[model samples]
Target: MNQSVFQKAMNEIHSRRLHASAENERRFQEINTVIPELAEINFQMAQTASRILHGEKIDKIRQQNLQAQRYARQLLVTHGYPEDYLDMHYTCPYCQDTGYFQGRYCTCLEKEIASLSVETLNRNTQLQLRSFDQFSLEYYRGLTKSNTKGETVDCYAKMKKTLDYCIQYARNFTAHAPSLLLYGEVGVGKTHLSLSIVTEVLRQGYEVIYDSVGNLTSQIEQEHFNREKSDINTLKLLLDAELLVMDDLGTEFQTSFTDSVIYNLINTRLNRNLPTIISTNLTPGKLEEQYDERIMSRLCAVYQVWELMGEDIRMLKMKERRSSQYL
Candidate 1:
């Protein structure tokens, strides 16, 4: 949980409380102007505490308060308004929009924190535009690829299976879900499918972080050297997020610091059994060449590796657009 995120959630909860209070006040003023008898009943109800302080009998005051409330309701209904219209309507009734209950944070507040944390992490991502439904198999039609087992297979069939698997993975995602490594040439829909999974997992209310490897590494490095003047612990959030999607894995500016940070990130998340999705243009050989053996070993042994097979979808789309313009 990031401190700034927590503070933002608290601020939102405070605003909600203020809004509810303001609305309640507004309704009271309206009803007071419309029905003066209800206003008198309200004043009498408000005097319960003062009467108790003045050594009045507690039971008598409690009875009087109940009678006043009933009379107020009757008056409201007789005046053609809902009996409970003047009641404070909190967004979350359990906490009265206060964000806490019984000395602990409420579930509604926790949900807000999780939602805001995801939003903060994905602030720069176009997460809303991608989905499994938007992924097309037409690009891979009439294509074929030889699998590692050396069998000729239809690329369209292969991609269809890959898409279905990704959909199921997203639908069934949990914190303990297995990590994934999606590898293929550039523009083969790796980022598309990864973002699709991210969209579904987020809809399921999990905190997900998605970004390019280069961008994430750069931020981590900047924060490490105290060059980025922000309180957010980017590395910690990446490690602690429910799901992390790292795109374009081999494109980062390599440095001793970045290499160490990347290794630590991969290693720590694996050790904690947290799920991660990594998309890269690098193959197994190139990945091993770029990262050290430890990182390679974890990815090879633990991650569910998927090779996306197709010609560049973006290039195909561009050619199709060009052909369409001529017609």
Candidate 2:
């Protein structure tokens, strides 16, 4: 949103120049028949000035009237006129604000518009994405004291390490990076960490598409079988997004069609070298039991599974919120 504002302001410069030229042409037209010589001189002076601005080194008789007009603008304050009146009329002294130099677009205007287009595309995405700074370490539950000299860790310490890994992964993510599997208990910061990665990747100018397995299952089904033979929009998003986030992967409604679609989506992206991040509460044993060994093995081969071990952070937050309310 903030980026869009900057681009829009820059585009306005071209619009102002166009408006100034149109107004000047109209004024010259009105006086052409009544004062032919004066009108001709003024039009010719504007033409020559425009040429000079456009990089043409032409020698033409100086129009004293044009210089007099400039002097009037420069000394507007001394003559009791508004200080900004001349500047308000600042048609680019370079291109007469026409934005073309030598029959080509000005460098300054082209650069601004190119930047604006990037910001405009970036604006298509939601900007206030969840980030690492806002992530809560409190989400990882209690841990017993760690022994000195390379001791075994507790659930809290293990999950804390996972959080740090997630932060680092997001910070340095590339298209070639390995896919991530976040298999864990419910409400143990799985979704939170995934969103944090989404936010961070967005800051790096990567397009990310977020969808839960359940939502995606229904969407693909409707697009493929229920309504249309082909859905171009769905295909474009899945193919073009820099990162594809599939949350709660194993909980979608089971069907032969859903199963095949899910498999194909993952398989397609993997073959194309696009990375996918999948989060699920199902254990590895359960994944094999629920989805066939074929699907599970394909996923395991393609992704580095991170099994999260922590109590429900949602319950803890609810308890804290209740306690604070009583106080």
Candidate 3:
């Protein structure tokens, strides 16, 4: 498991602890107002508990404490509140939101850590910035025509349609959602929309794995040639993620090993009916030339193909920056 996953779980436990404390205090304040003597009883109970350290028997103090608790419950019942309403409320009562019980990590914490581990193992934090709301279709402005290849050429209308498709895909994503192939030229929002989809999918609580093709291939190559067999293989993570988003698909240093690994990952995911999002700067013809027929067949046939059409937004941003500098 990733160390950051465990850290995230610990942070969640801290938040739950604070929430429980605040809830307890809020309830105490509400009840204390109705029964002023309840505060005195609580103080006396604390003092009585301290007597245990002095070797005093708790029989009498126990009876007094029981009576106070009964009185508190009765008062709560009279005021239309639950009997345990004033007690410390916990989101996870099993561990009291402490993430541990009986000197070990609790089930809830373990589950959270495991979920986060799967996500972190597959995720690229650098891609976290892009989102649906942040994308600007205005950059795609031009004609609405399609080229001779029957592909939508550079146009605002075509890009807007692609944007709508991605937004819908993200909004409706599930564990069993269809796989996606986002193909376009460089700086045409293929990566942007793919990242945005993953972000929305993550927000919906599904564990997603995201990585650029270059990074993914390099990591797999390193692991494949490692002398130590004990090292964890990232290929498993890539194949098993609930939603795998592979960005910059044709940018990796292609080789026999990388080609095989890419095929295995995509083919395996497809066989298992797992969803994957592939963003590439290559057309179907170019992709065929780069990869074999098997990989391209799986991607083109099985995945929901989305071809993005627009001007190079990166160049536009660069020119805008230059203009601003002149100003």
Candidate 4:
């Protein structure tokens, strides 16, 4: 993980602590309105403790402190308040918002760092601009049937179904949700829909790891092989994320390492029943040919496959812009 990202996480933890402390003080002030002597007793105890810390072992100081606490408790109970109500309310009591427990990083801090680090790494993508509501269905209107080669493949209906399924999938995503295999040609909104799911799943507070197959493989190779210089836990984050979305599956460099890594990752996710979303340009035949029968069988048997077909929406948008310019 990046050092700066870790620093941000630390800052967040400290900020929480500061806020809790301030709120606790405010609560105490509010309580003082009802029990003025309780606040005075607390102030006296603070002064006594300060003097004790400074080596002034005054006789009966400890007894006086205990008596003050007992009186405060009795008053609180009589007023229908919990004895310990004045204590700071921390979100994570394990670390008390300090991000560490017994000199070790707390689980809350680790999870926060992982989330921040992953988002930092994925910030290069244009995912923020792509959302289900923003995806225009107008482009798929004219070419309802037949693909680019004039094949009679009812492209429009398939595209519409794909869009609906993706939107629904995002709305009801769970850890055990069915894995998705989205295959089609370029610019058919596969990436857009996948990213839309990412946004929704994230909004629902689930961890999602979305990366192109090319970048995923490249990062794995760099970190796994070059262990000495690598600090990012790339593979761990991918495998542990609630949902993994690999866009443009077959665009990655073809190598023995890449093939094995992909197979292992997919197979592991399947074994664990973890949901994954894979979008590729390769047809079923091509996918089988490229990754062999094992991967194909797993995908076909376990994944909810969708084949989206439409003209390249990117080109359509470009043409529309040019036409508007001429107008």
lDDT of each: 0.87, 0.69, 0.80, 0.84
Candidate 2: regions farther than 4 A off = 1-128, 143-153, 226-231, 325-327
lDDT of 4 by residue, 90-159 (tens): 9789999999999999999988888886786677554563688898888886544433344666566767
Residue-wise C-alpha lDDT for candidate 3, range 193-300, written one tens digit per residue: 888888788889887878888898888788778766622347876777789888888888988888999999989999999999889888877888888998988887
Clashing pairs in 1: none
Which regions of candidate 3 deviate over 4 angstroms?
A: 1-116, 119-125, 144-154, 229-231, 324-327
Error of 2 at 85 (Å): 30
Taking all chains together, each candidate's TM-score versus the true structure is: 0.71, 0.58, 0.65, 0.83
Query: Which model scores highest in lDDT?
Result: 1
In candidate 3, residue 32 scores what lDDT?
Answer: 77
User: How far off is model 3, as Cα RMSD?
Assistant: 6.0
Model 1: how far residue 21 lies from native, Å: 5.1
Order of the predicted models by TM-score, top scorer first: 4, 1, 3, 2
lDDT of 2 by residue, 82-151 (tens): 5444233545666565556788866655545544543443344343457777777766656633322234
Q: Would you give me the overall lDDT of model 1?
A: 0.87
* Cα displacement (Å) at residue 168, model 3: 0.8
Give the clash count for each candidate. Answer: 0, 1, 0, 0
